[model samples]
Target: MTEIQAGLTVCTVLVVPYIVQAIKTKAMTGNVARWIAISVSTLCGVLTAMAGGMPTDASAWVTSIFAAVGGVQVAYAAFRSVGVTDKWLDALLALGDIKED
Candidate 1:
């Protein structure tokens, strides 16, 4: 896989669980730590994307990808720590839930 895609995959694997927990519990408090982690991960992803250039360089690509993962983890933890319920966070968590149709 390409560097970008690989980075995203790593992030997704790391972040999805916290999101699920937040939605299932509906208690932001429970995910404070995770939100912080995913936030960092997301931030790293953005930075890497902004940095541009080839991802083939093992060192750069690895560091970028690791940062992306950490950012995502931070994001999730931060989202929970915010201690407020909003439509957006709710919607995000709901994405993984069973849609009652």
Candidate 2:
């Protein structure tokens, strides 16, 4: 496969499992490490896509979309872990059923 295709495939393989696990766990309190790791990974993906001379057509789009989603997930998890709950926070936190510790 082409380089973009390969990169996209690798990103998918790495990200999908974490997304699935986050959804399956339904609790982000104890998963801070994982969330942090995912956040960093997504950030790296964003940087790499910007700098690695990769194609921006479809692979960039997919990576950006997933990275945004994962970033939001990580932010929500962090907020939930801090026990800050409001309507918006609740909605975001509710995505993973994260509870305050």
Candidate 3:
């Protein structure tokens, strides 16, 4: 494998679990710490994906796919922590028909 591929693979191996742990412990660990971890992991994932290049190979794509998923999971967890429910998310989706009555 290429140097870039090897570097990204190592980064993914290290960052993926950190991101998952941050999301899992966000409730007990405080949002600040969790957000810091999430931010770092997000940056690492982006870098890994960029280094991995196009989707021509499995290793090239897994980091990006997993990073995107991790980011979304953290966002959802953040919203849920603040008491934002699925109904609120659906309401946001229906902004054009918002009712004030």
The candidate scoring highest on TM-score is 1
Off by over 4 Å in 2: 1-5, 8-29, 51-101
lDDT over C-alpha atoms for residue 78 of model 1: 65
Q: Between candidates 2 and 3, which one is better according to lDDT?
A: 3
User: Which 10 residues in a row give candidate 2 its minimum summed lDDT?
Assistant: 17-26
Residue-level lDDT of model 2, residues 18-92, one tens digit each, is 443445434555466455556655665565565546555876756664655465565545545665433444466
lDDT of 3 by residue, 1-92 (tens): 45775566455544454444434432655566555555666566656666645457666556564654475455556655664533454455
- lDDT at 42 for candidate 1? 54
lDDT accuracy of residue 99 in candidate 3: 75
Model 1, which residues run further than 4 Å from truth? Answer: 1-51, 84-88, 91-101
In the range 1-101, model 1's lDDT, one tens digit per residue, is 45765566566645554555545544456457455446655565645654556555576666665666754555545655774334555676669899778
lDDT of each: 0.56, 0.54, 0.55
Instruction: Return whichever of 1 and 2 wins on TM-score.
Output: 1
Error of 3 at 101 (Å): 7.1
